[model samples]
Target: MLTDNQRGGIIAGYYLGHSCRAIAKVVGCHHSSVMSWPPAID
Candidate 1:
């Protein structure tokens, strides 16, 4: 599983306009995971 820092990295990258696939590649997770971040983060 990815650490919070890793997940935050994915969220930041996505917020920067990076594609879900790109964020997933950098964060080592599936693209679908991108949808579960950002908004779900508290």
Candidate 2:
């Protein structure tokens, strides 16, 4: 599971037009991690 910071970073990255890999890099996680964000966010 992701920490609060990771979850928030992914959301911010998505809104900022960052790619999955880029979001992972910024959030200090793997690209697959972005795929697991809360379903409500999708």
Candidate 3:
């Protein structure tokens, strides 16, 4: 499971126009995990 900080970073990175793969790299997670983030975060 993702930590709250990881999840928040994913959400923030995505909304800041970062790609899922890029966010995943920064978050140290799989790209698919970033892609799987809920749209509600957008």
Question: Residue-wise lDDT of candidate 2 within 1-42, one digit each (tens)?
Answer: 999999898778666444555667778776564555433454
TM-score of each: 0.38, 0.40, 0.40
User: lDDT of model 1 at residue 20?
Assistant: 57
Candidate 1 lDDT tens digits, 1-42: 999999888778667545555567788886564545455443
Count of backbone collisions in candidate 2: 0
Residue 37 of model 3, lDDT score? 59
- How much does each candidate deviate from the true structure in C-alpha RMSD? 9.4, 9.0, 8.8
- Clashes by residue pair, model 3: none
Off by over 4 Å in 3: 18-42
Worst 10 residues of 1 by lDDT: 33-42
Give me the runs in candidate 1 sitting further than 4 Å from their true place.
18-42
